[model samples]
Structure formats: C-alpha cells, structure tokens
Target: MFGDMMGMMGKIKETQQKIEETKKRLDTVLVDEQSNDGLLKVTLTANRQVKTIAIDDSLLEDKEQLEDYLVIVMNKAIEKATAVNEAELSAVTKESMPNIPGMDMFS
Candidate 1:
C-alpha cells in the first residue's frame, strides 16, 4: 500500500510538471484572424487574451462600421484561440497519459 501511494504521488508530480510546461508553451502561442478583405485584424493568445488589433484606414470614416467589423474579427480570433488552446491541452494530456483508455472523454 505504501509503495502504491508513492507511485501515485510520483505520477501526480510528473503530471503537474507536464501541465506547467504546457502552460509555458501555450503562453507564447498567438492566433490571428483577418477579415475577408484584409481590412480588419485581431490577434489572441492561446489562453484567449487579446494581444493586438489592426484596422485599415478606409474604415476610419465610419465608427459604427469599424466597431461592427471589430466585433466580427475579435470573435473569430477568440474562437481560433480557443481551438488552439484545446488542441494544445489535448496534446499535453495525451503525452502525460499515453495509454489511458477513454481519456478523450476528459479532453
């Protein structure tokens, strides 16, 4: 029983290390999305934090139109970031537990 407990603790420590490493790697991942005409752009980190945005000069004339386009591009960038975050997390989890059955349920 004591050996089993020690083994479990070791596994837990290893998993935590893997999670921390994943977080560090994910922090540097940036997801960017642009509008169809390349007039609007948005960027986000894998953790869903907004990093940057750019708009074309042509849209400066209309605040409402620019705001609308900003909303669309922001949402797209966030969605892309979320997808990337999930994929990164899933890969990390898989690496930690390579042979666990039904692990996809958690990811």
Candidate 2:
C-alpha cells in the first residue's frame, strides 16, 4: 500500500510539472481574429495575453463603430485563445492522469 501511494504521489508531481511546461509553451501559441470586413484585427496568445490590435484608417473616423468592432473582434480572439489554452492543458492533464476509479474528471 505504501509503495502504491508513493508512486501515485510521484505521478502527481510529474503531472504538475508537465502542466507548468504546457502553460509556458502555450504562451508562444498565437490566436488571430479579425472583423468580417477585415477592418479590425486582434492577436492574442493561447494564454490570452493581448499581443496586438490593428484598426484600419477608416475606422478612426467613427468612434462608435470602432468601439463596436473592437468589442466583437476582441471577444472572438479571446474565445479562441481560451479554447486553445484549455484544450492544450486538458490534453496534458488527461495524458498524465493515473487510472484510478472515480478519478475520471475528463470523462
């Protein structure tokens, strides 16, 4: 029983390490989103850190339109980034989890 407990502890530690590494890797993954008309663009890392935002010169003339475009484009970019981040972390976690009964959180 003690041996099994020790092995499980070690596996859990290893999984934690892998999760951290995966998060770091995700920082390099970029998600790009743009408006339908291609006037506004946003870029974010998989970690959901805003990298850049580009607005067309025409958008500068209309404050309300620019704000609306920003809200839509930014939300889309963040949604994509969140998905990438969650999927990557979930994959790492699911791969490292031990086969213990009732511990199937992913399922």
Candidate 3:
C-alpha cells in the first residue's frame, strides 16, 4: 500500500510539471479574429489578454456603428482565445492522466 502511494505521488509531480509546461505553451499562443465585414480586427493571447485592435478608417465616420463593430470583433477574439486556452488545458489533462483504476486524477 505504501509503495502504491509513493507511485501515485510521483505521478502527481509529473502532472504538475506538465501543467506548468502547458501554461508556458499557452502564453505563446495568440488568437486573432475579425468582424464579418472585415472592417475591424482583434488579437488576444490565449490567456485572454487583448493584444491589438485595428479599425478601418471608413468606420470612424459612424460612432454607433463603430462601437457595434468593435464589440463584435472583440467578442470573436475572446471566444477564439478561450478555445485556445481550453485546448491547451485539455492536452495537458490527457497527457498527465494515467489509466490507473479507481484513481481520481484531480483528487
């Protein structure tokens, strides 16, 4: 029983290491998205931090429409960034988890 416990502890350490590496990988990921008409573009990191925003000069003539376009484009960027983060986390989870019976990976 004690030997099993030691092995489980080793697996836990390995998972922790993998998760840290995954976080670093996620930091390097950038997701970019644009509005349907391509008048606006938004870029964000996989960690969901806004990186850059671009707007076409034509849209500057209409305040309301420009605001709507910005909102739409920002939402798209956020959604894409979220997907990137989730995919990274899922990869780490799958890589870390062992097929050990009666084991709760997170517990």
Candidate 4:
C-alpha cells in the first residue's frame, strides 16, 4: 500500500512539473487573430497580453468609424485568444490526468 502511494505521489509530482513547463512554453507563444475583412489584426501572447495591433490605412480616413472598428476587431481578437488559451489549458489538464474523480488538479 505504501509503495502504491509513493508511486502515485511521484506521478503527481511529474505531472506538476509538466504543467509548469507547459506554462513556461506557452508564455513565449503568440497567437495572431485578424478581422474577417482583413482590416485589422492583433497579436497576443498566450498570457493574453497584447503584443501588436495592425490597422489598414484605408480605415484611417474616418476617425470615428475607425475607432469603432478598432474596438470591434480588438474584442474579436481577444475573444479568439481567450478561446485558444482555454483549449490549451484543457488539453494539458486532460493529459495530466485521464481519470481522477473529484480532483480538479488544474484549478
């Protein structure tokens, strides 16, 4: 029984290490999302920090409209980034434990 417990603990530790490494690797990854019409684009880190934003010159002609479009595009980009982050986290969590009842390890 003790041996089995120790083995389980070791596996838990290994999983923890893998999670940490995945987080570190994710921090360096950037996700790029663009508007459907290609008028705006945004790059965001896996941690959800905005890296860069690109706007087409044509949109500059109308300041108010441009502002509105910017807001819309940025929101879309952020939503996409959030979805991607969630998917990645979910995948990592799933791989770490295939079956564990009442144990929300990633939480």
Candidate 5:
C-alpha cells in the first residue's frame, strides 16, 4: 500500500511538471485569424489576448463597414485563439491521463 501511494505521488509530481511546461510553451505561441478575404487579420496569444491587428487601407473608405468588419474579425480571432488554446490544453491533459475514464478535470 505504501509503495502504491508513493508511485501515485510520483506520477502526480510528473504530471504537475508537465502541466507547467505546457503552460510555458503556450505563452510563447500565437494564433492568427482573419476575415474579409484576408483584408483584416488579427493575431492573438494563447491566452486569447489580442496581439496585433492589420487592416487593408482599401476598407478605410467605408467607415461603417470597416467598424463592423473590425468587430467581426476581432471576435473571430478571439474565438479561434480560445479554440486552439482549449485544444492544446486538452491534448496535454489527456496525455497526462491516458487511461482515466470520464476524467475531464481540465475541461
């Protein structure tokens, strides 16, 4: 029983280390999303924070349309970044517990 407990503890420590490493890696990753035939593009961090946005000068003429497109593009960028972050975190969590059934602690 003691040996089993120790093994479990060891596994937990290893999993914790892996999670930390994954988080660090995620911080350095960026996801890009675009709209309006790529006329508008947004870059976001893994944490869904906007990093940058690029807009074509051609769209500047239509102020209302430009505003609407900016909103849409920003939303899409955030959504895409969130989806990617979820996927990456999920993959790491799953890898750490491959045999656990119905274990969605991360989700």
Candidate 6:
C-alpha cells in the first residue's frame, strides 16, 4: 500500500509539472476574432491576453459603435481562448493522472 501511495504521489507531481508547461505553451497559442463586417479585429493568446486590436477608420467616427464592436469582438476572442486553454489543460491532466479506483473524476 505504501509503495502504491508513493507512486501515486510521484504521478501527481509529474502531472502538476505538465500542467505548468501546458500553460506556458498556451501563452503562445493565438486566437483571433473580428466583427461581422470586419470593422473590428482582435487577436489574443489562449491564455486570454490581448495581443492586438484593429478598428476601421469609420468606426473611430462613431464612439458608441466602436465600443459595441470592441465589446463583441473581444468577448468572442476570449471565449475561444478559454476553450483552447481548458482543452489543453484537461488533456494534460487526464493523460497524466494515475489510474486509481474512484479517482476517475477527469472522465
């Protein structure tokens, strides 16, 4: 029993390291989103950090419209980034987890 416990502990530590590495890699994974008419564009990392935003010159003339476009585009980009981040982390965690009875939470 002690040997099994020790192995499990080691596996958990390894999984933690993998998770951290996956997070760092996610920082380089980019997600892009744009307004329906392409008036606004946004690029962000899978870690949800904004990288760039581009807006049409016409949008600058209408403050409200520009704000609306920004909100929509940014939200969409964030949603995509969140999905990518979650999927990558989940895959790393599930793959590294030790197979123990009643510990199938990742399933």
Question: What is the per-residue lDDT of model 4 for residues 12-104, given as tens digits with 9 covering 90 to 100?
Answer: 787778778777776788888777888888888776889998999998899997888778877876777778777777777777753546777
Q: Compared with the true structure, what per-residue lDDT tens digits does model 2 show for residues 1-107?
A: 99998998899899999999999999999999999999999999999999999999999999999999999999999999999999999998899978778888853
Tell me the lDDT of model 3 at 60: 97
Error of 6 at 99 (Å): 2.3
Clashes of 2: 0
Per-residue lDDT of 14-96 in model 6, one digit per residue for the tens?
99999999999999999999999999999999999999999899999999999999999999999999999999998998899
Error of 2 at 15 (Å): 0.5
Cα lDDT tens digits, model 5, 58-104, are: 88999998898889988887887788788877777667754434655
lDDT-better candidate, 1 vs 3: 3
lDDT of 1 by residue, 38-84 (tens): 99988888888888888899999999999989988988888888898
lDDT of 5 at 25: 81
User: TM-score winner among the candidates?
Assistant: 2
Model 3 TM-score, all chains together: 0.82
Can you give the lDDT of residue 65 in candidate 1?
90
What's model 4's TM-score? 0.71
Residue 82 in candidate 3 has what lDDT?
90
The global Cα lDDT (0 to 1) of model 3 is 0.84
- For each candidate, what is the lDDT? 0.82, 0.93, 0.84, 0.78, 0.79, 0.94
Cα deviation of 43, candidate 3, in Å: 1.0
TM-score of each: 0.82, 0.95, 0.82, 0.71, 0.73, 0.94
**Model 3 alpha-carbon drift over 4 Å, by segment:** 100-107
TM-score, model 5 to reference: 0.73
Number of clashes recorded per candidate = 0, 0, 0, 0, 0, 0
Task: Kindly list the per-residue Cα lDDT of model 3 for residues 1-107, writing each as its tens digit.
Answer: 99988887888789889888888877788899988888898888898988888899999999999999988888878888898888888777777766577765433
RMSD for each model, in Å, please?
A: 2.4, 1.0, 2.5, 2.8, 2.8, 1.1
